[model samples]
Target chain A: MLADQQFLRIPGPSPIPPSVQLAMGKPMIGHRDQQAKSLIKQLSPKLKPIFGTEEDVIILTASGTAALEMAVVNTVAPGDEVLVLVTGAFGDRFVKICQAYGIKVHRLDTPWGEAINPQLVEAYIKQNPSLKGVFATYCETSTGVLNPVKELAAVVQQFSNALFIVDGVSCIGAVPVKMDAWGIDILVTGSQKAFMLPAGLAFVAASKRAWNRMESNSTPRFYLDLLRYRNSMQNDTTPFTPALSLLFGLEQVLRLFETEGMENVFTRHKLMMQMIREAFKAHHIELLTPEDAASPTVTAVKPTDFQVEALRQTLKKEFQLTIAGGQQQLKNQIFRIGHMGYCSPADVLQTISVIEVALVRIGKQLELGKGVEAAQRIYLS
Target chain B: MLADQQFLRIPGPSPIPPSVQLAMGKPMIGHRDQQAKSLIKQLSPKLKPIFGTEEDVIILTASGTAALEMAVVNTVAPGDEVLVLVTGAFGDRFVKICQAYGIKVHRLDTPWGEAINPQLVEAYIKQNPSLKGVFATYCETSTGVLNPVKELAAVVQQFSNALFIVDGVSCIGAVPVKMDAWGIDILVTGSQKAFMLPAGLAFVAASKRAWNRMESNSTPRFYLDLLRYRNSMQNDTTPFTPALSLLFGLEQVLRLFETEGMENVFTRHKLMMQMIREAFKAHHIELLTPEDAASPTVTAVKPTDFQVEALRQTLKKEFQLTIAGGQQQLKNQIFRIGHMGYCSPADVLQTISVIEVALVRIGKQLELGKGVEAAQRIYLS
Candidate 1:
């Protein structure tokens, strides 16, 4: 039998809603035309509430990594010192990008499945008073660790010169992020994550403080230049011919989020996280991230007494549900289940039940339907 | 009545085929899954014939300009001498990208509506023997001027150390490009043009010589790094989460091209160019580029009597057919009609007929059906 009914429960390029997919299939329009202008004008303001920022949110026609690069290149100049708080793979990426641009990086390293301590960041800033910025990942998808971004932001604000930059790729839309209220100088996200769209568009919101640093920073940049995006936003357009199909999908997705209310959207994701965690706990599985620091969008579980790859294959071959393997150091030791974007309680229920069977098939000897029952109880409650 | 039956006759984000559209709407798959690997492996080799290269073709999830930046950043280092042959806006962009990287640029300036003379390029290289690279645009979309890339490549090959890099964004698929045979060291193109897909993917093909140069060039790069892409492609994957929907659409598009044959695809585009030029001549309209140097993909027409913007607006309002207006200096002086990718003889005929009506409606007296008659004659012959 053909495995045609595929379910993508990975960290990103998440399951696109049918309406968004239909919207993407709509015919292309001129990127510089009035129709495109009107669509952009309508879409930009709607994105602000999702970002929880009243500042400028620039849309770039690149991946999430490019947005992260923009956040670094536009804010810090060469010879400038910056602090990179590493909890997982993405935080290391920020350090690499900053180092590539000749910035002096002071890394605050944390274990893969743990959150960064905001107190440690404050202590580092106190000693390294010359630092220009501090980079943090709100959700480290690799280990499913949700960092304490609000606390981190508050700590960064204590240093007058250091700008707080958050890589919110896998968390922004699913979790609550108050960019303005939390005083995040720069916040970045991608469309493929919780935006319920395909991979192509990346967004970055910047406060005035970030813009001020950008004006003084002299990094050689072209494609990821935020100033160009800001200038084009005034005319309700982009600096490049945007991925119009994805933008159309984004418009539909934003409308769906608005209809459901942002608070309810966050609550739904939180519930999915809770249900998945409860289901795994009932199966006697241990999560990689500590319970208090686990991401609302993705859950990483340790593969105890069973081959994670074998279970993943069984799930793919028998159930047509695809999840993610661990990255870097944790490879083959853990597996990740993503419940972001258009994932529903039903999706969580199906995923849990299938994992239960796959675990037993892979010689884990887990009780059948026990995990499903746990998830059902959470859904019911 | 609704303007539901719309046609995009613009330069890019061209009319996506129904099959491609349907393929794009297929359910999402894991970026690192076996299914995705198989799809990517199946798709990459098919792209080689269109690119006319037997070398590495790296795919990036960004705009065409990003691919151009990659071409520059990989092949040459800062303080290296490079010749930027300017045909129009995109050529100027190449110059800016090079200059942004601190490359010493020797600009061979051509006017907005003219092609770069290969003899002039040869003379420049003869004078400047220390040039590390020569940047040229295969097709300038802004002015519809197709550069003499073959002859220019021949001239650049005479130098032992210099690399011939061509920005083939607008002409790679629509026009015949023999990258290996033409001695092109690096070639770049975007998906939105003749690939018959949405805007999200960019492609770059590199030769062995370019790879050698990249190893020694020390430019700070991460996301657009060719070496990273090469490393991942060995495993039939990308270094990042690709725009999977566009790849699915590309698979169908490549299949369609294979069904039609690559030579026949090029021939069809050439025929469309001929018919469009003949129709414009029948309307007593002058083309922006001289007959010998015009691009087969897009036709730029100078509006002698009618307002170009008014004619464009009328076409959109009355027939829902969107074409392109002039960019920068050519604004209001010219209009562009793109016949690349999925455009047929009938599309050309209809576009000409509508242009005739639009011109007449905007107070420029033109013979009805005159342009269409010219195109139809070419089609019938």
Candidate 2:
């Protein structure tokens, strides 16, 4: 059902801007060349404001999971006790990665579709005084819950021994994350999410404390080694041959962000999320996350009278709007609409209109244009 | 100096063809869609003949070094004895990766710019009867030496317990490597080299014996896990979200190879290597690799009268030809000419002409048109 004019409404790998694509299509350059070094120099400073950090950001040629793995390997060694605050699938994956490295994980489990409580995390930290680090997710893409990362970081800071690592893979750009202001130790993101690029490059920013931990950590790592990255970054390049095309795309993406102004970018995503949420409410649909915990990047809605899979297929086949379904345990119960990168007000209206028509065709007994009108109200306001 | 019209002649990231670039610029698709599955299906079979293997080839969204790491993590656990045949920098990297994973490595050290002796590897295998795996490189990109993979595979097969892993990152497509016929257990390659695509995707093919060893190995690995790939491959997709744009580029690259005919592709590379070598000889330049062990993909020539770095700079600044300098210990000692992937007879001629002009400009005593005439002779013959 994919075509030239199709709307990609997935949680990650949002629609790439034309400029980004054009930049990626440019001629290839050797990674160690002066041109590549200039690219690294151009992109490194530009990424700091987006991550809200003054520390050095490392660019890795890998997916988001790889960045998370790098964070784990670099900060904590084997037999180190870490706290994994699990809100959704991504947080569970963080637990899995730590467990794979022989790190003892104390899992703080919250139910699916809910955000982790900062008070509970604080209580756990107070009880477990020897915790080496704590892993949390800024936005749980699987359930569309954006956790209270600022409050959590504050709680972790109250106890200075435990480093705070945030998996900001899905919300770093679209949502406002002040990594330094919130005392986040290590924040990780990927190119596919809000970066408007293909899925290859991963960005990780570490504070002075995280770097100190990495200096003495005895984890056996080679390819995902952060110390090597720190060394190569001094020369304005990566330790390995970088994914050059993606880096090219990233330069244009960062330029686009700067031109648009980061504040406006975040505001636009918040407006899109508002429009989608209002449209869902107008149709009498139930959202998976509470209104306070909903992510600004994606919205998950539970299908009441219609099968989620059938509705998803109808939207894709009929309207050419490709959205995401629920993951893991949430599958078949909910469908998600993504309005992250490269999304505009017009895209939101069109997406809502298509969904309304699809729901009507599937005998959901919803009046046509109700969703669109609700979304247009947000746009007008 | 990396302008739009400049020629990129790096050893790994060889020039990308226009068709591949055009394919990469197509509208993005979700990695979990049917289109992505079809892409996997299309590319999997096409890659087999190129790798000269009939086994299951796993596509990973990482650098070639990650694929080498995957081979190590999947087959050998901690305390497992492995033999690494070091011919150049890439072979030394293999040894480092194994050591990082806590594998006991018995290194067979060969001098730089030289090929590993199969007899020495055979002797090491005979002495280390309990070796779990043996790692080697097909073409050492660092030294431009093409090891005798077929003969080495034969030697490794004689010791049936050890899995033979080949780093074919820079040589698989340009040279003739029959993975099955040569009894190679694991062959790894990257997308940037002879695939005529950007650097991101890596392909690793494993024979049944290697798979058997991987099933019982206890090394802790998550992201580079091969079993996850094997499971997802049943549905013709990757376990993780793949680098979609690179895969799009790969489809076109595979078609280009098919259109050119695989044998003709190999012959074309052989002809380019011959042209460059003959040109080097006519200019009285000294080559780093012995004539018999030279790679058909790259030529590493030691500077005689001219400094290697100075010559490389002249070629870049004056001729817009981006060649490679030596890596690691060979730095500033040798310059390499890459003729892999989209390189053609005309490209070879242009490169040779430019090198001849640069050598003359650098105060080296070389007759005008001599190198081009030697290359033309090889091209016409």
How much lDDT does each candidate structure score? 0.85, 0.86
lDDT at A67, model 1:
95
lDDT of 2 by residue, B1-381 (tens): 111236688896987776677899888998989988988987888888887888888899999999999999999999999999998889989999999989999998889988888898888899889999999999999999999999999999986489999999998888888899999999999988988889999999999898888889999999899989989999998999999999999888887787778888888888888888988888788889888998989999997678998888887775457999999899988998888988775566657656765676677876654565576557546
**Candidate 1 lDDT over residue span A96-155, tens digit each:** 999888899999999999999877888889999998899999999999999999999988
Looking at model 1, the pairs that clash are none
Q: List candidate 1 segments past 4 Å from native.
A: B1-381
Residue A303 of model 2, lDDT score? 75
All candidates: TM-score: 0.52, 0.52
Q: What is the interface RMSD of candidate 1, in Å?
A: 23.5
For every candidate in turn, the CA RMSD to the true structure comes to 25.6, 25.7
List candidate 2 segments past 4 Å from native: A1-3, B1-381
